[model samples]
Target: MMEKKLALVGNPNIGKTSLFNQLTGLNQKVANFSGVTIERKSGTFSAGNQMYDLVDLPGTYSLIPKSKDEEIVARQILEESQRPDAVLVVCDASNPERNLLLFSQVADLKIPVLVALNMVDVAEERGILLDTQSLEKWLGCPVVAINARTGKGLNELKAAIEKAKIPDLQIFNPQAVFSDNSTAEIHDFAHWLSLQSGQEYQHTESETAKTDIKSLQQARETVYRYKKIKEGMAAHHIVQSRERGNEFSFDRWALHPVWGYLLMLGILIVVFEAIFKFSALPMDWIELAFGHGIALLEQALPDGILKRLLLEGILAGIQGIVIFIPQIAVLFFLIGLMEESGYMSRVMVLTDMLMKKMGLSGKAVIPLVSGVACAVPAIMSTRSMAGSRERLIAIFVTPLMSCSARLPVFTLLIGMLVPARAAFGPLSLQGLSLFGLYLTGLLGAIATAMVLNRLMPEKGRSTFVIELPPYQYPLWKNIWISVYQKSMSFVLEAGKVILAISILLWFLAGFGPGEQMETAYNQSLETSLASGMQRAEAEQIALSRRLESSYAGLAGKWVEPVLKPLGFDWKIGVALLTSFAAREVFVGTMSVLYASGSEGETEMLKTRMLQARNPDSGSPVFTGPVVLSLLVFYIFAMQCMSTLAVSYRETQSWKWPLLQLFYMSGLAYALSAMVFQLSS
Candidate 1:
């Protein structure tokens, strides 16, 4: 009845996680590595009569680790607490040498090992003949070829796992595992090792035998002498085989500097169009439910402060945020799909040269994609960038990606006011505006990275190394689970903050600081001109005066002068500023602000927005200039508190999050001001 633990270990992009997911299904869970914030994923399933626990470990090239992630994997191997009962060593059959380099290291570790030869289909397509039996004979392990994408050979792999036995461990082959200087050195050492007898390494229920220190040192020396020769042989084989007779389906053409960029842009446009078209229905449904709730709340209660707070403030805030869920979910789904399907690495591959110009590795692509959701996770995703400097640049620039949180604010402004017009022969002007906003985020991020390259001292070779995983159809279950999890997390975490802000804004705007509002209301009633008309005007004036005297209103007025050119008055300036905590807050704040002193029939939310006026100028607000300005602001602004919190955690510094805040704010202000000025 003992619980058996198994680990799926492999090089990055090997689809090890996909196999793990296929096996575990809905039984999976995520946790932080024992002491580190880096996450570890695990799951359980019943295979045969036993309950099996599967752990997906961090990937590494070899146990002799370099970066923090590699160190974590190596440490887990050494530590008793994380010891797995058996290890599934995953490899790509098409590129066996690189995978074998990792496999050879794992084989020496002396654990219960099973070799998963992934991408066998690709190997066949490329005309590479893999003799699994010969490989098994050479490595002294069970070799199971698999296509994780199609569930092919999964049963064989599982059966192998169920019946596996750990072999007597081999000593580390330093010549093969580490750096080498000459081929002569390798041959001499291989002869020397052939002359000496290897001890039979053993493991017990409790302990693995200590590796011989003397032999290990000798192996290291031999490897240092011969590794260069081995690497050259591997490269030569790859080239001669591919060039002469066998041509791989994958090509260098995919990474060509000019064509690759144009391809990436075209793909990006297609993705955006898909996102917009797909998310429409869900967005409409969300908007309708939210609108219904607000109406129901208003109808259920008598006119009072509590009713007003609930109807105008809290309900409005909820409506502002809920509409974004579908869009954000779809965006995350598309990103996750790209990553899983392996197109993401191609982007990283293609962009590596460009990244050098911006002082980063193409590996920064991870964070760049993750930034679509929130900048925090995006920044943390830079852990794979291989250097602190590159990672830092990725962190600093990632916030400029205009995360999904900005969708609500942009959607509200664009959809409500921006009329449909033609920007070109066929494209809608509104659609072009949307694309422009997204481009602003992208251009600003690249600009910031370029400027930082100039400001910061750069050293060390930031080589961009990545694997282009074999392409496959996007998995439905995995995609659905990812979309659901990402969208739900946003709703639950940011929703709580937004909901609180809405309630707080309601209280602040509904009631005044002192007895000033009461006195103001009484005076307006007493100074009547024409009885009925005077009473109505007095009530409207009192509401405005009360709001002006309120805490939120006062704060708005204080910042109004600085923000005026963005086509925002005191009220709008306040809403925009408060929305820094969340973009959705602007909608909620506007709803409540307009609801307070209305003279027209309040029906659709759009109608309410249409009637809002600038208090000082006494002119209609939320016009073309204001709507365009707002869209530009949201496009350029980093307005999500979740994104800031994430950036703080990922970069392990307030400096980064603060810099992101100021950078985004400055960009937003500059862009918004330009739009407003041009339109005016």
Candidate 2:
């Protein structure tokens, strides 16, 4: 049977996406809409014998085009070819009036739609009672009260969808409210909408002169709809109870200028500490597992390049990334909690004044905050920003926000340099160090934005308007799904890059040009013997020399001089080169490079890094100063190729991305040099 197409529509931040997730489950995929970079999410599901294809349309406040997202929604609903078999209009049960505007507009287009009254539980908590039957009667369609969080009322919603049909009554008649001169323009617009929806225009032309749609006529239409809606709502008793509740009382403290910032800081500290402390045991287990696996493979497999590739190359690289999954999951889980609780919006409000001063749109806060997860998506979120100048600045500075990819890198280096222990009460010392690195990124972004704001031409004023969602306990199911998706996304995306680089690096590090590797090995044996070193130690030295003379080593040496100023050796130089593809790959690159030389050593990557010695000076390679320098560099550097590509795509110009690359890299080098030199 052919699948019926359904478009899920709603205002931003409602339960639309949650409902979509419940309906489609794991059958969804995200892609770009035709000829546009805006993300399109669609999925398929089977209900009984019939299948359905559900597309989650971009959320908008109205049918009238105000933004790119709104324009797309408007076009999709109005255009006959693109209209779905039915549109599912998800509305907030608590504030039905605001959402009803959009729903009424969609109903006017004559499409079959069912109102999924989401968050009814939240509405009940706020003492707002919704009369579904009254609402259904008033709208002339089915109304399903659904709690998208817990899958409540889902079966009923699905049942409603199967029998969905066009509304029995029109919500408003524009000609009834519009004056004579504007009646013609309003009638023409109605005609246009009908023609676009593939319906015959039935309105009589009381005025022959047709003109353009004016703001005055649009205002009259909106005013009339709301007036009729208010009367009908009272008549039908759709909203049985109303109360302001304690939201304002909570917001007073949460949005306070002083206590709010302090609360946010405390929350962050607790989160980071939780990440380090909670994930430690799991991380240890992962490391131990990989170590045992490597040992077993060593004992079972015969000595050959295949064994070496599997053990030192593929396994080592993957082990580095996999060991950090617990920490990654914990990080995302905590972030989800903050977002789900609606506290994140308060944080945005707190930073609004400061963001505007830095020449960012007040709306730019979302993109900047989202940068903490990953910059590629964060940069894309800037499309919703009102001004071009604001969007450009946001894209340029977003990568400076330390992403989850940098989490592993920071955790590794911090684990090596700082002891994992509580300090100054319950706060973990290592967590503080991690927090400091993130703070550095935020400060860097702010400083860069101020500079860019001065240099760039101002095109338009940026307006900041955001509604604070009511506070509620995070739904554990939603949190789990979020954490799962984010964690897997990181693993799958980073694993591909790490795997390919690991194999290529193994080949380059295992074999050298000509007889250089052979000569180095022989000379290392001779030197070790003359120094009276043990046989095992001498063999280890020989392996190290062979690696130093290999192609990868030669490449590292070529860049060693430039990096030496930051207290980084040739091995670090190699890791730096690989990390340009991805910041998280730094850990995997270090794993492969260290594992190849330490043949037969199955210790964790942390132990390997901690025990590393400078080839020339014989001093520890990752000293406090050097590790600090490395952390500083990663904090500011534009190391992810994906982010740069996204920036290019978003800006539609190489000029911005290239400038971003050079500018951020240069900043990273300068800051790292200063950190190392000053600390030394």
Candidate 3:
């Protein structure tokens, strides 16, 4: 049988994606539409004996195109070639009036439509009720009350979709409202249709006409639809109670000026603490297991380049990526919970005034908050911002917000520099220090936004528009899915880059030009024997000396002088260079570099890094000052090539991303230098 196509359409924050997830489960994938950067998420599912292809279109309030994302939605719904066999319009039951506007517009398309009244539980809690039968009769289609979070009413919704039919309802007619002066494209299309039907064109307009006839007509249509909706509600006795609700009471504090800021800070502290406390056991187990695996591999294989490559190059790099999975998973889990509970929208409301001072709107807070997870999608989230300048500023500075990629770097450095003991009652000092680093990144982004606001040209005033969604219980299923997806994405994306760099670095560190490596090894062996070192220790010393004469060592030496003032040595310089491919690669690079010349030590990367010394003075390389400096650097550096590429794609120009790269690199260097100098 031919697979039927279904489009999932709704306004922003209407639980549309939740419903899509419920229907598609694990059968979905994300891709970019042809010739466009906009994301297209499609999935396949079986309802009864028939299979259906579901496309989750971008959320938009109206058919009018204001941005690229919205334009895609308009084209997908309105163009005949792209239109689906049927559209499932998901509406928030808690606030049906505003949601019905989009539904009315989709209904006017005269396509097969089914309404999914989502968040019925929240509506009930808020003392608001909807009469599904009455609403279905008024709209001339099926209406299913669904709880997307819990999968309640899903069977009904699926049944309705299987038996869906085009509604014989026309909520509004353009021909009745548009006259001779209308300039909308809809009016032009109506006229063309009339001509094809043997009638004369009834509308004409000069290009200079100042009237927004389409908007005016839409406003009128909205009012008419509300009137009909209200009458149906009255007939069905659907009404709201007079008492104030729990969600309202909660928002009163969550959105307050002083308390809201305090609560947000507390939430951040709790998140960091949770990341440290919850992930500690699992992280230790992973590190220990990998260490044993490397030891077992070393014993099982004969001494050769292939054995060394397998143990130091591939396994070590993968271990670096996988050891941090627990922390990444926990961070995403908390973020997903906050988002599902509807608290994040309130955060946007609370941060608007402060964000305005930075020349960003409240809406910019969404991307900024999401930047903490990963900047690629965070920058994509900025497409919903109203103005180009505000969106650009948000994009340029968002990289400064410490992402999950930086989490491994930060955690490793903090473990090295800061004590693990508790600072207060139950909060670990290391956790507090980690939170401080995250706060530093946020402050850096805000400062950069302020500076850019003054320098960049603006075409128009920035607007802050947002809707406060009703509070609902977070679904553990959704949270787990989100955590799994994000954690896997980080591991898979960073793994590929780390593996390639590790192999290349292994070759560079293991081989060098001419007999320089041989001479260094022999001299080191003689010096170690003269110092009366053991045979095993002497061999390790000789191996280390040989690595110092290799290609990667030469490259690090070239940049050593510039990095000296920032408390970084040649080995760190090498890691910095390799990590530009990805920030998390710093850990992998260190793992491979430190493990390359070792004899049979089975210690983890952290222990190896701690034992590393400056060959000239024999002092520890990762001292407190150097560790702090490196931390500051990673927090500010534009070290991820993926972020730069995404920024370029988002802006559609090399100019912005290039400037961003130079600016961030300079900032990182300057800050690291200052921190090193002050601490030392």
Alpha carbon lDDT of each predicted model: 0.69, 0.79, 0.77
Poorest 10 consecutive residues by lDDT, candidate 3: 194-203
lDDT of 3: 0.77
Ordered from best to worst TM-score, the candidate numbers read: 3, 2, 1
Model 1's alpha-carbon lDDT is: 0.69
- Worst 10-residue lDDT window for candidate 2 reads 195-204
Local accuracy of candidate 2 as per-residue lDDT tens digits, 1-680: 89988999998778777898899987887766766666678999877788999998987777665455666787777667877999999999888888888888888878898889998988899899989898998888888999998899999888888777777647667567766564455453335344233111222344346433444455677787788778878998998999877755778788777888899768866875676688889987887888899999999999998999999888977875676578767877877787788877787787788998888855776677667767765676677665567788999999999987798789889988899899888789997898889999999999999999988865445556677878877777767877776666556655566666667777887899999999998998999989989877677668767877898788888999999889898989878877776687677567656653332233477887888887667998889999999999999999977677777777788999999999999999999999999999
Spell out the clash pairs found in candidate 1. Answer: 180-227, 181-225, 376-646, 376-647
Per-candidate alpha-carbon RMSD to the true structure: 8.6, 6.2, 5.7
TM-score for predicted model 1 compared with the true structure: 0.78
Query: Which is better, 1 or 2, measured by lDDT?
Result: 2
Per-prediction TM-score, please? Answer: 0.78, 0.83, 0.83
User: Where in model 3 is the C-alpha error above 4 Å?
Assistant: 35-38, 119-129, 175-180, 183-246, 300-307, 370-388, 403-437, 564-569, 582-631, 648-654, 674-680
- What TM-score would candidate 2 get against the native? 0.83
User: Which has the better lDDT: candidate 1, or candidate 3?
Assistant: 3
Best by lDDT: 2
Look at candidate 3 and give me any clashing residue pairs.
none
lDDT of 3 by residue, 1-680 (tens): 99999999898877887888899997877766666666688999988878999999987776545456666766686667887999899998877777877777677776789999998777787777777776787778888999888899998888889656666445565455546444355543223222222111112344346545454454554577677656756776555442346775688788777898899879866876676689889988987888888889889999998998898778866875686678767877887888888887787787788899888987887678767767765676676676678888999999999987798789778988887798999788997898799999999999999999998865445666667766777777768767776666656555566566667767777789999998998998999899999877677668767877888778888899999999999889878987786687677557656753332232366788899888789999999899999999999999977677778877889998999999999999999999999999
